[model samples]
Structure formats: structure tokens, C-alpha cells
Target: MDMLDFGSPRQTYDIRVEYSLLYECALGIGAFTWDEVHDKLDIGQAQVLQIKRQMSEALRREVSLAGLHHTWRSVLFLIHRCPYLPSTTQEKHLPVFMDWLKEIKDSIRTEAAPYLGASYQAPLAAALAGNALDMQKLLDEHHENPVIYQNLQYLFAVSAEQLLDHIKRLVEGWYEEVVSRDRNVVATLEQSAAQTSALSQNVSHEKLIHTVTRGGEFVAEPGVTTLWLIPQVSYRPFTIRNHLPGYAVYYYPVDPDAQTGLDKNRLISNIAAKHKAVGDVLRVRLLELLAASSRSLAELAQAIGASKPSTHHHLLLLRTAGLVHVDGGVYGLNVDEVLALGEELCRLLKLDGVKAAQETSQGR
Candidate 1:
């Protein structure tokens, strides 16, 4: 089945400029690598091999297994879902690439069957095991807010080295495998010649010089040839810059030499204490939900996908933390203290902005 045939694909998130990534990798943005892309296509075949083993067991339609995969298609489906994860922290995209190979398994079932045999999944799985990109996390859940830079800042948890290495390998491999092989030069030269002919007739863009190639030199080869894949990159200026310095402001860090680090634990604890009385994802979700609408314990549980007992525990924490107030059967922002909460959040955001600005200035 075509994965994209379901309709316009679901709204999935993307961390970077996805097309740029595809251009760099030589595969579609969501495609797997050269060696491993076919391997994912074979994992299903491996599953079929397993299914073939159990065919003689007529008494059972299913064989119990870890992860409880009941059939080959289900296994394929699971792999297909692997690329829909929430984080992209893999040190290398090569490792979990097999996870993406799930998509091509269908292609392997037909035209690619010869190359994608039983041994195919082995390399694919190996690539997955070695991949640095989290096959389960980074696939489609990247941040999408217009504040793209803030979304990047949210990824500060990731190390810079991992990002750099993945991009470097991806771009280099793409250039070697897909880009350099194109014989665009001859085509371009020919097209340029065609233009040359047109131009010898005084056509536009004719240097009025026929060009020739001898000893690997295009000595103005006296002909019009269109150039193709001429590995030349240039950028046109968006605007002419006439630097008329209208204003300049000099700012210094409050303590340029001060060494400081944000203690995530303390930051969470402080925010929690100030807001939810406890800094936690659940409580934060609760605050957000409450801010929008008053809801009962059951509604809270359903909204947060937590068990009643779990939701209760969190509600208790929030109530005790004095961040929430319960009334009737609904829980929500303490109507009386809501203003204070807003003030606090605004102050915090402002403070963070100031600190960020200070750091940026100091870096200069």
C-alpha cells in the first residue's frame, strides 16, 4: 500500500528545512540511506521467513513473541511507525535507518526482489542498531512554531557534535552517490553551443565566440553548447547594501566573566514551586488545561491520558502546591490568583529574554 495514498499525510512535524536535508542526503527528506533503504524493504521478507517456519503449526494461527507482533504485516506496520517519534537525538542517522526502510519493503516485494533478499534486513537492522538519529523519535514530531529559533533552542539538550557529524556525512554521501554522477557538463556545453549557434546569428547571451574542446579544454570551441550540471554556486544579492550607520548601541554583559550554568533541576523546581507547586510535565499540562477550561477529575484524566489514581495524585500535588483550586467538580486556575500567575510567567519570560540577549551580546 502506498503510505501517502491515505490522503494528504497527517500533519507531521519537521525540525530542519526538510527539502534541504533531502538535497543534502540525496534521498527524499523522509527516505533512508543508499545501502540501508533497501534493507528496510527486506525486514518484511525476514518476517515472511519466520511466518514460513510456523506454517506447519496448523494448530496455531499466531506465535507469541516479545512486543507481541502477531503477523508479518504487523511487523511491517510497526517499522513503518518507527519514524513517527518525538526527538531526534541520535548521534548518527545511519544507525536507525532501517526503521525507515519499512516504507520500501513494499517495493522489495516486487521489482526490487532480486536485490532485496533474505540478507537484506540484516544490513538494514545493523544500520538501525548503529544509527545516531533516534528512529523512534525524530521522524515526524519536530517543533513547528514560527519561532523556529526558539524551537532550536529547545533542542539545546542535544550536543553540537552529533548534529554536525550527521549533516556532514549525509551531505558528503549525497554528493558522491547522486550528484557527481550526473553528466550535466556535456549537456550544458552542448546547450551552450546551441546558444552559441543562435548567438552567432546574434542571439542573446552569445559571447559571439565559437568554443571548441581539445585536450580537455573548451577553447571557445566555436559553437553553442548548453551547459548542464555546471558545478557552480552563486547567490544574487537580495539588496544592495549601502551601510548608512543610522544608530549603534553598545551593550555589555552584566558580568561578562561570570561563569554560570542553568541547573535544570532547580529551574524546574522553582517554576513548579511558583506555578504548579511542583515542576513536572503532568502538572504543567494540568495548568494549561485548566487555563483553558474547568474540568472534572475524569476529564483531566482523559485529557492527560493518565489513570484516575495517577491524575488524582497530580491533582493533589497541584492543589497542595497552591497552583490550582478545586470548586464543585471542576479544577482550574485559582480565579483570584490567576493574575499573579500571569504576572509571574511574564516576568520569567522577560528575564529569560534579557539573559539571552546578554549572552548574545557577550558572544560578540
Candidate 2:
């Protein structure tokens, strides 16, 4: 994999920022913790708790019926497959999204499965369960299993409208309350987009990525052509990265002017947090355990032979330091953040022995 260096031939990347209510709703209703949201955004504790409650109730009533994973899978599919047409009203995007789902269902039903093997449906089902967004690729990769096909077909029929309506309600009801008041969400995004566009025009892809990704990273490899810089209000202080075969998206946190006070001290504080997080023996062991596979809090505690509260304390520190992430109630290490910490340390110390000394002297 080739790293995109700061000095390179002008390879232009289309950088744009947009607000998605459905995307926010999807993430809000998914595996993310409300604590994470509160940690990053300027939202009140009571409001955060209320939003969490609303999300829980909505998921239980609507999304859970279709299986939360399946619903999220659909959400990802919608994001990746559906063309986000330019519109002032966010709800206008829903019809196109629904149409895409309908098309996928229609193709699977009418069009014969492409594979000739014993069971394409099994592979297809596994792919769907695995959150494979591409319908054709799912068909091509695995022999069709009737069970898988039927389950998906049923899911589409039963849950598609429910999922859309659920998103619609959340967007209208919850997202509005959280973001609509005095929040120039679109203006913030437009500013970010314009700034990004100008920066990209002048800077290399590598520098552009480093600036926007915060503590996170963007890997540019062969066939990874396009990059999306989407700003969101819900998932704050953390940039969620998603990659398909051809493209990748970085859902950046929308930090308003008031919350941007930490900019001057964020790097130093983050470095301190990272070092402190890894300085613990328990946290190191926890990372070792999570390296293999994601685990629940109970499993982590049991593996570490520590009490749940004790284990959670260490995990909280790691999470606060951006060394770990929770997905679907399971904790996983942010390998990129881990690697970036090492790079940051090296950048601080490894450049020159004399330079480090000179910086210390200059500070004095």
C-alpha cells in the first residue's frame, strides 16, 4: 500500500461536507454510547439522556423488530448505494433511498442468481449479515441459499418501510430538537467544505487527510480513489471511518465555535491521554484481548480477572484517549489511533536529538 505523501503530483480529491439526518439517526440508534456523544458535543446531560431514551424506544419499537444489525446493514447500504441528490429538505433523500432498496429487492427476485453452485443464498446471506452493501457482489461471491434469499426478501418486505419511517421520525423529532435551535448546521458544513476544497487545491492528499482526520487516519491505497468528508453533530470528537471497495468516508464531528476552544491544547492533551492510557498494565492486557476480536465488558472483565467496575474504569480511560471504541455493546481497539500515537511520539522525539534539546532550551 502506497502512502500519499505531502509532496506529490497534484492528484485532486473531491472533499465535501454535508449533513445527513438519517445518517445521524442511524449512528444514534446503533451501537454508539451516549457518553461518547456527550464527551464530544456541547449537548446537556439531560438532553443526551433524553435522546438516548428516545433512540432506545425507537429502536425497540421499530429497528429491533427487523433486527438492529439488519436495520444498520440497510442503513449502510443506503449510504453506499443510493445517490444523495442535492436537496434543501433532507426528507427528499428518503424516496431515492427507498427506490434503491426496491431496486435491489427487484433484482434479487426477478433476476436469476448469477452463480451456478449449490448455494449462492448462503454466501449471499452471510454477505448481508456481514454488512455487504453491494447486492451484485453478494450474488457473485456466494452461491445463493434459499434461506438467505428468503430472509432478505422478507426483511425487505417487512422492515424496509418501518426502517424508513423510523429514520423519518427520528430525523423530524429528535434530530430537529438537538440541532435545529440556533444551530447553523448547514452553514458550518458549507464552511468546512469550502475550506476543505481550498486546502485540497493547495495541499497534497496526505496533508489534507491529516488535517481533517484529527487523531484518526485516512489510508490511500490502490483502487481507493474517492474520499468523502461528511460532518455530523451526533458522533462528536471522533471521526468514524467507513470503507467500501472503491471509496471511503470519514464522518467528521461537527465542533462548533464555542466547543473549538480545545483546538490549541487538544494535541497536547490527547498525547498525554494516549500515553496515560497505555501506561496501565490492565489496559495493555485489555488491548491484547481486544486485538483478537471484539468482546463485551463482562468478557473483558472475566479475561482480565478483574471486577466489572474496575475493568470499565480502565476501558473508560482508553476510550477517552481514543484508544478503544465500542460497537454493538462490544469493545474493540482503534488500531489506527494506536498506530497514530506511536507516530506522534516519534514525530515529537525522533526528528532530531538536537532539535528536541533546542526546543526545550527555547521554551526555557
Candidate 3:
């Protein structure tokens, strides 16, 4: 007889919805750093420029002095490293985060020393660890990688203490001047998180992640046991993925419905955008290839006989329309969204009246 054996229990994870005004404060500042040609930021260029101009001279001076526009990603690292407690306000967390940064300033410099002047791909983990990388080399080597190389260059030039001080002042000033003025932003973030939390209760983890990220997939690695889903409006139209020790984090775009509350015009605009995305012959061809199988930019370009830039532009439109999703650099069609187009149109036009009438007639 075989020995009696008990198998190991399967590892599982819990998804938690969290929101903080601090995140919005940092991301709002980061938004100014986005490049028009590459980043698909939902905020119009004119709006972003106008917002920047509206900032107080002191706040604007700190932003420029700290080179926050170049090293803006550093603020994200600071936020993630800071311990968070649910329901804590930005006021409560800001001082604590700054103190923590002060305590670890030396260690940050130590960790960063090895990478300075060395050629390496700038990984988010490394950046979070305070590494000062060689941006020029990174650009030369990985031309296609979408990173603000100036971030690394700025890190290399500044001392860790200086960097931390600059970031602290910038964040505090931002919260006071920008975030505090708009109480509605905090309410919006909280409402979005609550709505997403409700949806998560009824959906499976995979389905919830896919829906929230607009079709992006998540594959857990070993020892990961929790997912932190944060709904944000500052980084609208972009779902940012990040990681920390034993936890995977997603700062996803808030749903339009949560923001606008059943506005028919917004619905119509969304439908029109989707139709426009599919209108181009080249885009249709790109979708045809993606429908058959997932592909990379180079692969899709070759398949459609288009240049990389042209192919990327078409794919961007499809992605903005929710018909395409890219995960880990591989592009795939969002079949569910594609299939729902007809139903969406019908609902928008109130054609559901016919179905309701037929159902009423056939009812017992």
C-alpha cells in the first residue's frame, strides 16, 4: 500500500480596493511630464498647459528646481514605499512619508551608487530602490523602450538627500495648492474605489482584473498573495501596473460611468469613438491580424505591411476604443468588447424596446 499523503494547499490571493488623495496628488504632477507623441494621456495638451500655468509661482519654482518633470517617477516610488492605512488622509500620511524618506536617505544613495555611470535597462524595481542609472546608454541600447531617460540622468546628478528634499517640498506644496483646492477629486476617487469594490464581490478575480484594466491580463508569480487595485482619475486612459514585495499593484483608470453618472452624451461619445476606431481600412487589417492571434508591434507591422509608427498609431486608436489591449508588449484583440458593439448601439438607440415588447407578449 502507498503511504498516505497530504498534498500542499494551493496558494491564493485577495484583491483589495484602496484609494488615497496622495496618489492623485503625485500622479497629477507626473501628468505634466507626459510626451504628446508617446503617452496616450486623456488630458488634452491645452488643458495640461493651462493647469501648469495656474500653479503658484512657489509651487512652479519647486517643480522646476527639483526637476520633477524629469524625475517625476521618483514620487511614485516614494508613495509605494510609504506605509498606507485605509481611511488615512493625505495630511496624516504626508509627514510620515517624508520622515521615512529622511531616515532612509543614506541607504538610498548606497543602493544607487553601483548603477551610476553603468549601462543597464532602467527597471521600475531599480528605480524604486533609488538607483541612478545611465540614461544615455539606455537610450542607445533600447531605442523602443518607453521611459523618460531624463529621470535616470537627474537621479545621477543629485544627491539622495537633495532628491528627497525636493520631492518632499513638491509633494507637500502640490497637496496644499492643487489637491486641497478641489475637494471633489478626493470624493471622486473614493466613489470610484467603492464602485469597483462592489463589482469585485460579484466577479471572479481574473474577470475583475481584466475588466478593470480594460482587457490587460495578470499572471501571478511565486509568493504573490495579494492584489491592490487603486482607481485613479489623474492617469485617465492609462492603467499603470506596478509591484512591491509580495504584492502586485494596479493603478487603473476610473470608469466613465463613475465620473459622469449615466450621461447619455458621454455614452454616445464613447460609441462614436469606437466606430471611428474601426473605420480605417488599416485599423481593420490590424484588428483582423490581432483577432487571429496576439502579436508584438514589429510582428503586427510586418503582417499588415505598414511602418512601425503608422501601425502603432492605428493600434493606439483601437486601444483607446477598448477594442485592443497590450500586455507585456504583446497586443491582443478584446473579443468581448468587439462582440458587445451591436448591443451597445441598440441600447444607446433604445432599440431594447422591441425586445421588451416581444418578451411581454410571450410571457405566461
Best by lDDT: 3
**What is candidate 2's lDDT per residue for 221-283, written digit by digit as tens?**
555668877766556666777655456677776645634544325455657768998998999
Order the candidates by TM-score, highest first: 3, 2, 1
Model 1 is weakest, by summed lDDT over 10 consecutive residues, at 233-242
TM-score list, all predictions:
0.21, 0.47, 0.56
Which parts of model 1 are misplaced by more than 4 Å? 1-272, 275-278, 335-364
- Per-residue lDDT of 30 in model 1: 17
C-alpha lDDT score of every prediction, in listed order: 0.36, 0.58, 0.70
Worst 10 residues of 3 by lDDT: 112-121
Q: Mark the regions of model 3 whose C-alpha exceeds 4 Å error after superposition.
A: 1-11, 37-40, 64-70, 84-87, 108-149, 261-364
Instruction: Name the lDDT value of residue 123 in candidate 1.
Output: 41
* lDDT tens per residue, model 3, 303-324: 8899999999998778767788
Q: For candidate 1, lDDT tens digit of each residue in 1-364?
A: 6565556543221111111112212221112212234334322333223222212222122222101221222222222234532144322333344344434443322211111223344443332344434422322233343222222222232333433333334334434333332333223323433443343444222222112110122122212132211111000001001100121111111111111222233334445556645468988888889989889999999999999999988987666445566666577665434455566555656877888899999995
For candidate 2, list the clashing residue pairs, or say none: 119-143, 119-144, 120-143, 120-144, 120-145, 121-143, 121-144, 121-145, 122-145
- Scored against the true structure, residue 9 in model 2 reaches a CA lDDT of 75
Candidate 2 contains a number of clashing pairs equal to 9
Q: After superposition, how far is residue 96 of candidate 3 from its true place, in Å?
A: 3.2
Q: Is candidate 1 or candidate 2 better by TM-score?
A: 2
- Better-scoring candidate (lDDT), 1 or 2: 2
